[model samples]
Target chain A: MREKSGSRVSLRAMALLLCALIGASPVVAQELTTSLVDIHQGSPLSDRARGLGNGGYELQSGNRVSFNQWYRASWVDMHVDLLTQITEDAGILWGFGTGEQGEKYRIEPSLKLGFLTQMHPSPNSTLSLSLTTTIGGKLTEKSCQADYGDLGTYSVNCRLAASQMAPEETLKYLVNAKPESQHLWLNYRVTF
Target chain B: MPARHLKFGIATAFAMLSAPIASAQEAPDADEMAALCHGGLSICVSATIPAARTQAATTPGWMSPDVGAAWAAGYKGKGATITIVDDFSSTSRFSGNFGIGVQTQRHGEWTREEASMIAPLATIRSKDFTTSSSVTLAPGLNVLNLSYGMYATAGYSPNQIGWSAEEASIISYATRGSAIVSKAAGNDSVAVGGVTNGQQDYLDLALVGKASAIFVGALSTNGTTTNKAQLAWYSNYAGSNPLVQSHFLVVGVDGSKTDLYGTSFAAPIISGYAAIIGSKFTKATPTQITNDLLNTARTDTLVNYNASVYGKGEASLSRALAPVAIR
Candidate 1:
């Protein structure tokens, strides 16, 4: 009789534990795996090809920027720019982080805003840099045919200084040198 | 006190009545497909893929010259029908190969010519479904050869959102006695660790739809002469980060044979072998057949070796057919 009572008590304890575990799981979900904001900065162009003469092209591209010439090659900025992170408490956070950026191209003409990340991040808020390689945007217009001889092997020419789009919008903006244009930049983002 | 005992009895009866009801709600019955060959038997071949593609052979089907020889050796996959499932060209209709009439127009034809090469006297039924579609799999189909991978339209992320829906139906056919063989893809993605597709790890967290799938990966074409069986450069590997390591098998894909690229090519070889094996063991379930085949695979000399990559090693067709003779 004593053993039977003991077994019954143990069964009740097991059931209670199971119930408690199921109930407590919701709380676990609330625990932050990573921080909300780590850092955001303009990264280098991954596949941007610098005119390495002799028919050979040097690929260089940007990370933290949006551009129209996704199907075309991107160029490197001649000036020095510092990109940094905005952190709360310094610790490692992982998972996906989203942020926005605004860019005014000195020569290129375009407006852009979007999120960027390489892959899923650890469930924590960390800051790091990552680089991404991608193909340029496609050219569909006959005017593009006249400007760029071939649809392939073209580059994003940032030398075109822009004030505003013409009233007719004849010139389809290709690459935007602004950070907002970067849809998803591959980078080695450091979280600290 | 008497009322409490009455309550307990009622509870026990209620529990018994609810058990089957819950099961019925949880898992419904599976579909039934008509058998294709005689008494619904088949030959299940699991060969390294140099046998099928025309480019690989001097006269086509050269890698497994032994297979045709086996047929000539009086080991006809006779009285058996084989169903091959692959992303073949729209016109190469399987009928040109399997020697059977179009059982259903929904899929392509399996020509008797190919059937003559494997089993001279068997009826063949071929079914082809676009990789994206969730088609119902049937039993008694003798042998079902899936010579393709979980192909997603290019540019799409490898997410399991659409695949989960069809898991139950696929699992049902596998549970029943259906000779089904799927190529373990040719891409050499190591399945030992979590296979990162593009950039995400594929996890089989939900066991809702998984059978002992006969997944066959690829090896170099040099035959058994090579010491190590490196996972073909494109075959995706299986491992446990989301879970544990449970990948597929790898057979030969060497020689002058060029059709040895994707698991898509390797699947049919196993399907052909399964047809041959099924001919011998007339009453084996698809699950049992997969087990016996895997159990009979050759051991490799690689380290940290587990079933994730070299599943039961390379498939030995003769041994699987003549299990009792050599063992």
Candidate 2:
């Protein structure tokens, strides 16, 4: 029995090692274009991205990278675009006495389907419109904090009660929450 | 009775039982095992001991329902080591009879057994504090099970409780976040720092504010999803110090099941739980594992849960094990 149990443990350890190796491997993809952009309203990356009333006015800046593939459909031209953006060191402020305030980083990856039409009225002018859908969720490490002054100072690190730490809001969501945003985005662009 | 007297008694009994055997055989028959526990030896024998031995013979070890889910989920403390710091006779005596079904009547022996039962795959090491106060921590994830207390005469202040090498090593480890230290909140029926019966356990005072130290209290029975549990009548409480309360946790002792009672039995459960949590979160620091257990403890499972009384309430192994990231 001891031998069997030892063998089972060895097998599990090997499996865990394989999983770690796979998870640690870097993701590789072709890069097309990179640009810095700031969202003034309704950014799909932030948790507070509902609207102006819900603090959507908070400016979010990130480096946006676009990957594109072009194809000709019967009459008009078409292109599939992949937009990837990363918001680095974004501040996550907590309400009074709610938790320890901190910062988080997020990455938003989206796909866009669009059509292109040439205009004869203007030389070398083109019009394009695309439906962009963004997909993202909690992508940062979880943390716990408490105000040692407001809550009585405790000997333990992170003195607040577990409920006060809001683990369900911070840690649980990392495991069980769905994509943060999945709304249709309409964009029109004029290029020369 | 002095510890030396008990040690001599146990050694003599074992010698008598082993005299007829030429080679190592199956653990002494049940009748012989029972005889070893006769007279003052009842401390080693309980109604559950024989049954537990029978069960251990067939299975790896006994696990309480509270930690059963973690075991089923392949987190049976495979990568962790639990160093039990208690009195398990002398070094030579313990080394001679430290294996499955080899029961002894020492405080540390039962504590070791309890911890192994909870995390069957966890590496368990004995540091007989009676012989030496120095504890050498094992590599990898470590949980220090201190089911025994270092006490002083009544009215001794925290500063006056001369710290031993063992205490210093444990405090240093806990302060440095090197290991999770699970200490038994003495069975004095008073607050954690309260004095009882002419002595005070200063180990509790020294551990306060340490990064990964936890004071474990006992509940009368196990709490389940449907039923809530209550603090054992003799268990020490968290008291008014929020710092102490923040690091305190309570687990069921279930004397009827283990045939042993007191905060001593409660500490091993938490130690085992820490090891199980470490098994899952292999990358988690000792402090992270400590916070994971404290942050995920269940208040609703304890009747009229009060932080001052129950500390962090009943430790929920399932809740602690639920999180993918233990920060």
Candidate 3:
């Protein structure tokens, strides 16, 4: 009878703890740009990426913003004394962030800047110079870790092992690598 | 504090600590960014992008060489019948807009065009599932393409729900009858997960559809080359189910139109390959065709490959159509 009483008390305590947990889970739905956000979890590759055991999630919480847009903006260029418009430029650009391509699949920031500057020297002839550059965005050092289910690799190793089949099952490794991607281009043109 | 109270408190703390582990990645609305852009933009200006007009391949004027090689072998699905099942093809929902037979519907057209690249002479049939009679499956069809799946209602658990009986039986009956049912793995950007054990995961449509089907997932590409095929982030998948692994596959997403995406477009490519094999074998069963593709799938196609994420591997028409020796 004394043991039974103790068991009953334990059950009640567990339930109370679970209730408290359930009550606090609403914070997950909350989003903050500068705050930490859980992108995905239980990723075996993510675990290896961060040197965690097996299961861990990826995050995208920082001051990074996704911006992609194109507009036709026209502004007349006028020097201190010049009256007529000499050059005009109109172009489109897109800036975005995504996971890196290698084994350490971390977040990568990217931006594209472009402009077309045209000089109207005469009514029948004109010269144009087009400049474009792609800027790689900053990387976030923050990541999330969890208890990996070892349920499956989820192909995080497909590319890692694409060259050959793996021999070890217990060795903890990540399919995603902290992405180190760099892509930049600049174009200069003059057309008549 | 008493010993019992301390013990309970420690246990409570552990449980509380583990609670967040059960959390999953949150998915915003279809146009969540769009909504955000619209809001708080009353003072700022935004630009709009028009739909793509050229719809050209971003690759070097060629999508993949395997399909062409299969066609070169003279298979070309000459007499085989390839059936595509989707709502966009139904007459009731056609709406003279983007749908099957509506030349304007780029999504539907892309699937047809990709299939044609392999079996130009095959008899292509489009069955729109709008009513009872339309959903019927005719026997002797070499391959049936299903590029859709069920989505869970918001706030509901997918692990608890199962596929509808009507759909389940139809796929199963077809599979048993020797028709390779190529099904879509489904898109991400939604709450549903692919078929697998555990929370947030879903069963492969083959199991829920109660049919031995090839569940296809989407593979994103750089379009500049077919040398590497990466799994799409928004693709639904499964890795632990031994029963379904042999039949699940993923292919490059940028197959058809430049911007066309989703596993929906992934199914037709495999179906087309099956048709190419059928054009030659003329007597091969769906199981045989399925085996040919699975046995021939390659790991080298993936940059850093793992079976759990990629499944058997990408479809290989040349290997699938290769001659088998009498060993």
Which window of ten consecutive residues has the lowest lDDT sum in model 3 chain B? B19-28
Runs off by more than 4 Å, candidate 3 = A1-192, B1-62, B89-103, B106-109, B132-141, B153-166, B174-177, B189-203, B206-211, B222-226, B255-257, B324-327
In candidate 3, what are the lDDT values of residues A122-162, reduced to their tens digit? 66556654333444432222211211111112222211111
TM-score of every model versus the real structure: 0.39, 0.51, 0.44
TM-score of candidate 1 relative to the true fold: 0.39
Q: lDDT tens string, model 2, B26-61? A: 111122234423233111222211110111123222
Model 2 lDDT tens row, A32-123: 12221222222222222111011100000111111011111122111123222111211111011101112222223332221111223345
Ranking by TM-score: 2, 3, 1
Rank by DockQ, descending? 2, 3, 1
The DockQ values of the predictions, listed in order, are 0.00, 0.01, 0.01
lDDT of 1 by residue, B14-87 (tens): 11111000000000111122211112122111111111111111123323433543343233454456655433
State each model's CA lDDT, in order: 0.33, 0.52, 0.42
